[model samples]
Target: MELFAYYRSTSSYRVRIALALKGLDALVVPINLLSGEHRQPAYRAINPQGRVPALRTDEGSVLIQSPAIIEYLEECYPAVPLLSQSLVTRAHERAVAALVACDIHPLHNVSVLNQLRQLGQDEEQVAQWIGHWITQGLAAIEQLIGDSDYCFGSEPGLADVYLIPQLYAAERFNVSLAAYPRIARVAALAEQHPAFIKAHPANQPDTPT
Candidate 1:
């Protein structure tokens, strides 16, 4: 298996954490998003969406989108389950993961922020836009989450995988995590977990010095 990823990408980070938790190993192929490598013809052929974290499976299948990739991993390798078998609990976990990946993330991804700039928004204004959405999303997540060690329970699961990466993005953009103590606490605990430690952006081969 091969994973094409950009180290700092929140979406890619989610898959990395999932893979580590399942004790799966894949060749890391770094796609430098900052250098526009994803826009090139070769990468576009691999992933028509031209996104990071495209997984080339041992079966010669290519998977795109972080959520879909994670889902595939979950189905194929269920030993270390990231989701509960209970329908309700699974739905709840999926919702929490979607809250970050879908609602909060898309609004401020590189493409969207670049679009905002093209439409006459300055850098600071674009940053404010990112910060606003992240704050709003985290506030909602705080309300939904209980006083558990991870997002849904004592063990790290799907929501924790999603949350940790978003927190990394939040900290990178200077989004005020001070308002969400529950989130802060969960992320701090996740950092200490071996899987998460291995999946961190700083530990990735593509991370810039």
Candidate 2:
């Protein structure tokens, strides 16, 4: 398998964490988003959406979108299940993941931030936009998650896969996690998890010095 990804992209980061947790090895094909590599025709061919985190499987099938790719990974590699057996628990885990992936992350995505700047929003305004959404989403997640080591449970699962990258994005945007202690606790626990460590943006092949 080959993963075409941008090191700093939170979506890519989520997929990397999922892959690591599954103990799967895929060659990292660095796509420099900053350099506009993802917009090029070459990458567009892989994913017409022209985004990072496109996974080319061993069978020569390409998977796009982090959420879809993650679902595929969960189905294909069921040994290390990301979701729980109970339907209710699985729904709860997916809800937290969606709160990060669908609600929070999109607002502060590179494209959205660029659009904000184009619409006459200054850097300070852009920062505020990112902070506002992230804080609101995380605050809700903090209340939704249990007092477990990980979100919803002791083991790192779907929620942890999504939350950790969002936390990284929060730190990048200078959003304080101090207000969300449960979220902070999960982040602290993830720091010691080998899968999270291995999948961290700082440890990626394309990470800048």
Candidate 3:
């Protein structure tokens, strides 16, 4: 197995956490998103979408997109289940994950912000654009989580995988996590989990010194 990823890519970070939690051994190949390596022709052939977090499975097929790849992992390896067994509970977990992966993360993606700059938005405006969406999303997640230790249960599940990365991205933009105490609490606990610790951006091979 081989994972093409960027250390700071939130999407890639989600997969990294999942892999670690499952105790899977896969070669990690860094894709420098900052330097547009993901957009290069060679990488584009590997992932037509030109995004990081593409996984080459043992079967020789490649999977792109973080959510889909994670689902595949869950299906193929059920030992460390990330989704809940209860039907309603599983749905809610997916919803929470989508809340961050779909609704929030995209608005603040690098390409999206670059488009804002292309349209003449200055640095402050771009930052505000990113913050506004995150603030709204975090507010909703705060309500959804209430006082849960993890997003869905005592153990970190799919929601926690998605939430942790979004929180990391939020801190990068200097977004105030104070308003969402529940999220902050959950994030703090997750940051200490062995799997999460190994998957942290600071610990990645490509992370700059």
Q: Which structure among the candidates has the greatest lDDT? A: 2
Query: Where's the lowest-lDDT run of ten residues in candidate 2?
Result: 145-154
User: For candidate 3, which ten residues in a row score worst on lDDT?
Assistant: 145-154
Clash statistics: count for each candidate:
0, 0, 0
TM-score for each of the candidates: 0.97, 0.99, 0.97
lDDT of each: 0.92, 0.95, 0.92
lDDT by residue for model 1 (140-178), tens? 999887798887788989998899999999999988899
Q: Looking at candidate 1, what is the lDDT of residue 47?
A: 96
Task: Evaluate residue 29 in candidate 1 and report its C-alpha lDDT on the 0 to 100 scale.
Answer: 97
Cα lDDT over the full model 2: 0.95
Q: Residue-wise lDDT of candidate 3 within 1-209, one digit each (tens)? A: 99999999999999999999888978999999888898999999999999989999999899999999999999999999998898998998899899999999999999899999999999999999999999999999888874768888888999899999999999999999999888888998987899999999998989999
Q: How close is candidate 2 to the true structure, as a TM-score?
A: 0.99
For every candidate in turn, the CA RMSD to the true structure comes to: 0.9, 0.6, 0.9
User: Candidate 1: which stretches are off by over 4 Å?
Assistant: none
Tell me how far the alpha carbon of residue 79 in candidate 3 is from the true structure, in angstroms, after superposition. 0.9
